[model samples]
Every structure is written in C-alpha cells, then in structure tokens.
Target chain A: MIVDEVDKQIILATQAGLPLVAQPYQAIAAQLDLTAEEVMQRMRIMQENGIIRRVGAVPNHYKLGYRYNGMTVWDVVDEQIDYLGQLIGQLDFVSHCYHRPRHLPEWPYNLFAMVHSKTKTGVTEKVNIISQELGEFNRQQEVLYSTRILKKTGLRIGR
Target chain B: MLSDFYMQLLNDYQQDFPLTPRPYLAIAESLGVSEDDVLLAMQELTDQTLINRIGTIIKPNKMGKSMLVAMAVPEAQLQRVAGIVSSFSEVNHNYERENRFNLWFVLMSSTGELLQDTLDEIEQQCGYSTMRLPLVADYFINLGFELDLERDQELDREPDNGCDRLSTN
Candidate 1:
C-alpha cells in the first residue's frame, strides 16, 4: 500500500475509523486542509486500490446477540474444497468462510467457516444447513465452539 | 424498536455505504434527515459503542500473510502463556477455546517466513507445541449484521473505547 502525502493525511485521519460528525468529510478536510470533495475522492481512489476494504461499521456479532460462535471445519476433497468454500461462503447463514491448511491425523479438516447465532441450537441449525450444502463432498466435520474470548482487541492504526 | 434512522443506517448500509465526498450528506438524504443531524447521530452511536467505527474492515490475508495458531497449555499456565503471546506485535488476536487446545491467536506479517518465525518463537517461549493454519483458501469472508431488536438489551456489553490508539500490523 504505497500511500502518498495526501493519502497519508486521509488515512491517518480516517484509519482510526471515520469521525461521526454531521460534516464528517469537512471535519477531516479541515485537519488536512483539503477540500471535502478532495478528501472523499482520495478515499474513493484508495478503496478502488484496495487500501480501504469497505467503508462501514464492523458490527461486533457477539454484541449483536450472536451468542454461539462455531468454527466449522470440513474435510473436503482438496481440489473441490476451494470451489466448495466459495459456494458455501455465499450462503447467508455463513458469517466467515475460509480454506485453512490441515494438520494431518490430529486435524484433518482443511475447510473452515465461522457460524454464529443466539444459542447453541441456533448454531446447530446453521451447521446442519452447511452440512447439507457440503453433502457427499464433506468427508468429516467438526464444529469448534469458542468458550471464552480471552482477547478481542482489533488492531488500532496510528496508535 | 430501533429508531427509524438506526434501522436504516445499520440494516440498509451494511454492504455499501456511500463513498461520495459528502458521504454522510448522501446518507442523510436517504434517511430524510439533514447531513449534520445524521453526523450527530452517528457520532453518538459510536460514542455509545453500538458500532465499532464508520470506516473500512480490511479482509485478513488480503494485503499480508496471516495464520491461525493454536497452543495447548495446561489450565494453570493459560493466562501467563496468553499474555506472552499477546504481547508480540504480530499477534493480532489471542483466543481461548473449549478444547484441550485452548490458546489460539492470529499473526499477520509482511512475509510468510516472518509468520513461521514468529510461531516458532512462541513455541520456544511458551514450552507448548503450536498448530499453524495458514490461509490456504478463503471461502466467504466479510462482516455485516442487522441488529435484531428483540435481543438488543440482551446483546449489550460494556462498550469499550474503540478509537484508542492501536497499531496497524
């Protein structure tokens, strides 16, 4: 991410998360001495460039009543897991989906997805839906439930 | 019930919030409120910690390499062990799960070699074996959830100050 001076100003200003005032851009513009239009344009360019992922609030699912956090791992055919992961990820019930390297014997699951709901049963329902999605391709599966959140700190930039 | 604006902001704009110069103005227009009013409400919601921030959520492994690591520590040493792991600059998140494999954390780095080296260092320091699950593939990874009003009060937690300075790894 090669950010120029103006982009740096924009990032340093907004990376902590966007300010929440009425004239939010103007507020950032004042600090950078760039026009509000200019600041927005720079951020838009950054987004297009992948410097910014998406502009919005990242809801704390736990805080949103997703009481059960299940890490669903699946043993799918290697060649198919990549394609299967994409299909499963598009399911509304799936919050997070990934392809992770598996540790053989002890951990033979290569596909991973995170499912969350308000209760354990709610989580099971979602898992069942996923299992059905995987069907014959899923050789085996395990749902690892998070017991305690030992640490939940998100990286804060420019700290 | 969620305030009309709250529903609109949290539910309607999950996937795409405006990227316009006056983004809030655009939001305000849709919500039938003045731009300044929308700004005030958003700030208050943020201050209230209902939302993390009105900014970007970078997808992991998008820019740099990262891995999910697990360490099996005896119950007695979990805390001290976790502290050591969390202190490392590269450790993004440290978690405790239900299995015998209790301690898990994430590490993101500029290179894959750096990621391996960090995991090795933790294994040596903590005296416990580690499991590394690197991002071999990404299925569906993104975040957005419309608040279920029925569980609003039940879902509330101590809203931590989120804007405090933290480093971007």
Candidate 2:
C-alpha cells in the first residue's frame, strides 16, 4: 500500500506499542522531529483509511482477571449471517465479530463471535442469552477457550 | 510533523525488551526521562482506557497446538453462552460478528488434539456445534495508527512469513 509520509511515521511509532512515559507522544514527536499536531493528524488519517484499526493499548485479558474467554463459531443460513452478526456484535462481552468462509470437513462455521468474561458460569449465561434471542443455532456450535496467550500486539510495521 | 517525544515512545515499544525487573525504568533511562514519568504516562493511558493491558506475547505453536473455532449461538442465548465460553482458559479472544456463525474465538493449547477436546467440552456444555478452522495461511500485517499523525517515508517493508505455519498460532 502507498502510505503517506506522515502516516508512515505514526505507523512506525505505534506499531511497537506506545512508550511507557508521561508524554509518550511528545517523546515520539521529539525523536521524529515533528510537531505533536503533525503526528496526531497522521494517525487520524490512517484510522480513517482503515490502515490502523485503533490507536490504543492491546490489553492482556489473562493478566486483567478475565480468566474465561472463548471464540464461538456458528453455522447459520448465509442470508441470515449479517442480521444476526450485528446483534451479536452489540454485546459488550463480545470483542470481535466477523464473517469467514466455512472451511468444510474441518471447519463448519460460517460466522464467528468472540466473548470474554470472568468465569465459565458467566460465559455460559451469556451463551444462553444469545441462543434465546436467535431461537436456535447451527446443529454444531463450538467454543474454543484460551489455554495460553501467545503474541498479542499491534501489527509489526512493514519496515 | 509530530513532536519527537511520541516518536521516541513508539521506538521503545517496537522491539522485544529484556525481561528484567523495572523494565519501565530501563525504558525511561533510554528516553532520558525519569522513571516516574514513564510510570505516570502508562497509568494515564490505562486510566483513559486507551491501553487495555500490557503483558508478554505468547507463541502458541511453540507452546503446543491451537485452532481458530467458530459457532453460531442463538441470539437469546448469546450473552449466556459467552459467559460460559469465556470461563474456559483456552478461549483467548471472543467476538460477536454480524454473520450466521456469530461467535468466534481462538483456542490455544499445548496440542491440536487437546484443543479439539476442549472444543468438544464446550459443545457439550453450551449445547451447540462448533466448527474449528486452523489457519490455512496468514498474511502477517502489523497494522497501527497515529490517529492524526503524518506518515514517515523512511520505514517501508514487505510482509513476512507467508503460509509458513511457523508464525501463526
């Protein structure tokens, strides 16, 4: 992708994650020899372009007391995915939601949902609510919980 | 152009740092700032909720085996199911998408078989079917935004790790 100069700097600075300092942005600007406004502006552009999803910290849920979390997949009629997906996305506990092609034999889900909670019981309760609203789900729905947290960081810049 | 300070912070966060006590202090020293300043900035970010949490990144494949699983949970039972699904430590990220397969999450385990077993348990527990999709190929794009910052022309590179299966979980 042909990224602009200002966007490039901002990408480099944030890709690694923000510095641990009082004026981290200021520090980034100083090193880059650019004004604060310039940096912030570039970031805004990248966000608008969808090049950057959001400029924020990637939280470690495990460390933050979110012991129970699961990725749920569903097999719904292709036509109904969008309708149900939006409703599912609105749940506060749900973090990421998207539509992916169903990988047959091995993967049967056409829609995906992610949820985070404090305990297994809580997660089950949330699942029940979703089931009730939709009336019913695919014949097979699976929840995959996290056993270990691997790499969790922003994208590594192209450089 | 952004102030040099923010750039410095970005630079610090870009690499894997030493797993040392007082890691923030070391970062502060490198930036020629007091340790307190580093701590405060971090606190401010967290307070504002701009930062979710700071921690180590685990390499899933190296640790064992894992799979990306999805399921369509009924709308009425979405919340209840999520609460139950999250209870399992194996589920790392959970999202509600606008699709038939409404629930999606990543299941990481020390072995692929173990991951499957965990999914089975979830199906039995939630009374739903799950479709497991191990990553076929991944285009590792480390995307980040500066909100309103300008782009730098100097740092441009190509994507790394193409279908190697070694890079993804």
Q: Pick the TM-score winner.
A: 1
- Candidate 2 per-residue lDDT, tens place, A1-159, comes to 346566556565655655665455566778789876676666555555555544444543432334566666677767777777777766666655666677786667766666666567877887777666555544567665543322232322110
Model 1 chain A: lowest-lDDT 10 consecutive positions = A150-159
Q: Give candidate 1 regions above 4 Å deviation.
A: A1-13, A29-38, A49-51, A156-159, B141-143, B151-169
Lowest-lDDT window of 10 residues in candidate 2 chain B?
Answer: B160-169
Instruction: Considering the two chains of model 2, state its CAPRI-style docking category.
Output: incorrect
Q: Return the clash pairs for model 1, or none.
A: A156-B166
Per-residue accuracy of model 1 over A1-159 as CA lDDT, tens digit each: 676778866775775677666567788899888899898888888878777766776554555555566777889988788779988888765766888887877888888877767778987998999899888999998877765555656653211
Candidate 1, chain A: TM-score against the reference: 0.83
lDDT of 1 by residue, B32-146 (tens): 8888887777776676665667766555554467778988889999998998898888886777777767787777776788778888888889888898887766654454544
lDDT of 2 by residue, B36-109 (tens): 87687667545543344343232224334656666888889988787777777777666565566667666676
Task: Calculate DockQ per candidate and list them.
Answer: 0.45, 0.05
Cα misplacement distance, residue B103 of candidate 2 (Å): 18
